[model samples]
Target chain A: MSRQTPLNAAHRKLGARMVDFAGWDMPVQYTSVIAEHEAVRTAAGLFDVSHMGEIEFHGPGALAAVNGLLTNDLSRCADGQALYAGLLNDEGGFVDDVVAYRFSAERILVCVNASNREKDFAWMTARARGCTPVDRSDEFAQLALQGPKAAAILQRLTPVQLSGVGTYRFTEGAVAGVDCIIARTGYTGEDGFELYCAPVRAEALWNALLAAGAANGLKPAGLGARDSLRTEMKYALYGNDIDDAHTPLEAGLGWIVKLDKQDFVGKAALERQKAAGVPRRLVGFELTGAGIARHGYPVLKDGQRVGEVTSGTLGPSVKKAIGIGYVPAAHSAEGSTFDVEIRGRPVAARVVKTPFWKRG
Target chain B: MGNYPGSLKYTKDHEWARAEGSRYVIGITDHAQAELGEVVFVDLPEVGKQVTAGKPFGAAESTKAASDLFAPVTGKVVKANEALKADPSALNSDPYGAGWLVELEPTDGDTSHLMDADSYVKLLG
Candidate 1:
């Protein structure tokens, strides 16, 4: 059996449809995916994201030690700042994508995907030359409050000024007497806060926040809504849209890779891949036929397979069958035509921008 | 609406099969569609295509996931839902009515392998 989060009882109480996602028994949806998806896009939605992994790196050389482990330069990171970065193997394959939060010059917390917890923590510990890496994934719980009114909703409950935290920044404060790490980062494209608190105090804080935001139309969200929300914004989900086989350059995540930094894992390999030019690039498209494009669907050009969709689903907000996939870099141009094989028939599609849906 | 209809037989895979003279109309159970979320696409099997009981003939895509549209009883496809070709949300609106995936001429007259609404509801719980 997979592990259960602290919100498991609460999810079951809300009539959630439970599913095993990456070894966590989590709720996929409560009522409907479309309604929950629209709620987060237009209004507010609460997500139980305690299943994510959190590792604390500390010591005198913590900054340099952790910086060498990540592709992004940590020197640019200041207290209350967060950086989106990736960890890579020496061969340049992706280890995992993470969010690094710098609390002080000697302290940083890296939030990684839950499924990669053990592997990521091991990689960091094996390379800890002058610092300590602690696996604190189980010591905390997190909730994501997302939408346009997130800040307004959260401000009433917390004494701290909510507007002070900029994008990719965090504030360490108290909420309902609990030490909370409020970060302005989220998988969904909307402005939001990821609230982290003690594992023992998680349920109480969740109840407090939900109670505060109830009348404001902040409904509880689940993985189903989360998937649709991220898909609409074209955010990559590990294992589906990204994996160890793809490089940062091919995955269109080159922005997170810092080549100017000193020798880091995969630095030389990434440089070679960057210089050689990537053959396949991740691209987004909208299916033009009677069917929705989905993962594993073959993309064909004149009956020859060019690539397969990595992630595909209907965009509830945009009302379109949008999908993202890896295609030949030559066919990655906007408006380029291709066909996705759907149940034997070649469904027409066109390469568009990354996000098929945008919030107004 | 609570479960697969009583008179209709069901497959463990979730499709409901109802006998109509020499043919059977096949679609997913209300439970199936609800679990799959809002249907966005339905891949219909071509008319005259042969299918076996408990085998996949086509697929359905929804906001939640991709579900296989299984043939409840062995038959030859006679009619496929053409309206769903462009808009699959029709299934969510009326899964028992317009969302009927296909009509097939069954090779056998007996539909013993499927379940009625009462049994299907119990299976869901």
Candidate 2:
């Protein structure tokens, strides 16, 4: 049986199409993926992301302990800020990509992919020094209110000034009478807030947000819209675009890796890989031919299989078939031509700059 | 939870076929389109292409995934819905009418192997 999130019942009440995602019974869409995708781009969309896991590090050395395990330099984040980072194995390959929220010197929170929850907790607990890592996955339910009108909708329910929270910043406040950690962050490349509240209070929060944002065109989005929205932004999805076998540099996430910082888990391997020059790199492309390139579809160069598509979708907002995949470094440049084999036929494609949809 | 026209014969693969004189009009069932979700592209064969029963002839690509379109009866394609190449959401909106994939001139003119609306509904259940 798949695990149910706190708002599972609420999702069913809203007539959502439910699917098993990362072993959790989550809503894939309430109405349709295209409508929900357009809503986030034009107005606002609310999402239940409670299936994502959260791990808390406590004690005076919390920051240092967590930073040691991450490829990004967490020491740079001030309190009330969050940074995206990669938890890598010693071989410089991703264990999981995560977002670390800095609450204080002693209290830091790491949000991880739902599929890597148990493994990530165990990995951190065994290696953490001078701090206690607690699995708080079941304790909190996460809701993402994303898009242009997110602040206006949220501000109507909370006394906390939404303007005070800048991008990637967070603050503890009460939303609809429920205590929540409101973080100005999201995966959809929209200005939004990710609210973390008690699981018991999730249903109330969800209902309240929907009611508050109804007139503003905020619809209850699901995992399907979430996937397409993030894909347009070229945000890497764990187990697809990034995995335990691929290093962050090869995944086009080198911006998050701060090699100049102190020694981390994958420091030596990353240093070595950087010196040797990364071989294959991830590239975003749009199908110039007839078919939609899907995940696991072979990426070809000169009629030979060179790589595979990691994430692909018909981008509703962009109105094109966009995809991301790995290819040789020579073919990873912008405007480089290749073919994505769709249904045993090679379809022409061209490498393009990522974030397929840019905000006007 | 889809409307299955009683006049059309159905395949277990979720295709619906309607006999039009010697030729048959073919398209996916409403249930199949709903399951696929938001058809973005339809890859139909050329007008003169040959297709065999139970064999895949084309594809319907959705935002989430792609599903193969199987032939319900063996025939030579007399006409292909070229309009779907520009607007495939018609598959979801009108699976029985505007969304018809192809018109096939059946070689055997037999559909005894296919199911009726009642039987297809039962199969769906």
Candidate 3:
């Protein structure tokens, strides 16, 4: 049986179409995927991101233990700061991509993909030396309020001055009388806050936010809009885009990998790969003709299969079929043309610089 | 459960056939459209193309997944909905009306195979 989130009943009340997402019975869309997606880009939208896992680590050895496992350097991260990091296998391929929040010198919290929760906790626990890695997935309920007007809608509840919170910054405060860890972070390429609260208080907080934002046009978005919005921004979804078979470097996430850091899990393999040069590179493309290129669709160059699409959609904001995939390093440059085989038909497409839709 | 027009016939694959003299107006059932979410693209077979009963003639793509559109009866495609080619969301908004996929001139076929509205509703359960 698929697990249900704290707001599952609320979603059903709103007439959300539910789907089994990574073992969780989650809302895929409340209205339509395009409508919900456009709402996030234009005004504001809410998301029940409670399915995402939160793993905590605390102790004197927390920094050292976490720094050894992640590809990004945690030593430079100050309290109230968060940084995107990659957890890689010994062979330099990504096990999962995570957002590591530094609560203090001895405490840290990592938000991970829901599907990789158990596996990630076990992986980190086995490698941790002095610090204890705790699986706290069930303890927290996460909600995301995203878009240009997100702050205005959320400001009505919390006493904390949101203007002081910058991107990747967070603070502990009460929203609508419920204690929460309000963080300025989001998967969609929009300005937003992720509110992490106790599971028991989720329903109250959800209803309060909806009531407050109802006038400003904040609709309850679901996993469908979340996926499309992230795709438009070219953010890698752990399973579909980045997995054990692909390294962060090849996925165009080299900026997040700090090779200069000392003794991380995948450092050796990454160093060798960097020196040898990456054979393949992830690239973004837009369909020139017709049809959407879906995940696992064959990408062809000169009628020969060259790569495969990892993530794609007929982006609501962009109003075009766009996708990201891997190709030979030689053909990975912007403006290179390719054909994606959709339903046995080769539709012409061209490589383009991604984050297809950007807000002014 | 979604609305199933009593005047139409349904296939197990969730397509509906509305008899219009010699030609039948074909579209996906309301239940199928709801399950598919927002239809981003509706790829239909070209006009005059031969379609066999129970065979996939085209596909309907949503943000979540792609579902094949199966022919309800052996027929020759007389007209494909060109409007849906531009705006496929019609399938979600009005599956029984503007979302009609194709108009086909059906060949000699067994009428007993297709389920009526009551039977289709029962099968859905």
Counted clashes in each candidate structure: 1, 0, 0
**Runs off by more than 4 Å, candidate 2:** B108-110
lDDT of each: 0.87, 0.94, 0.92
TM-score of chain A of each: 0.98, 0.99, 0.99
Deviation of model 2 at A132, angstroms:
3.2
Clashes of 1: 1
lDDT of 3 by residue, A154-255 (tens): 899999999999999999999999999999999999999999999999999999999998888899999999999999999999999999989998999999
> What TM value does model 2 have?
0.98
Best DockQ goes to which candidate?
2
Please list all clashing residue pairs in model 2, or write none if there are none.
Answer: none
Give candidate 3 regions above 4 Å deviation: none
The CAPRI category of model 2 is high
**Candidate 1 ranges with C-alpha deviation above 4 Å:** B108-110, B117-125
lDDT of 2 by residue, A47-116 (tens): 9999999999989899999989998988998999999999999999999999999998789999999999
DockQ of each: 0.77, 0.82, 0.69
Docking class of 1: medium
Query: How far in Å is the alpha carbon of A123 misplaced in model 1?
Result: 0.8
Model 3 reproduces what portion of true contacts?
0.56
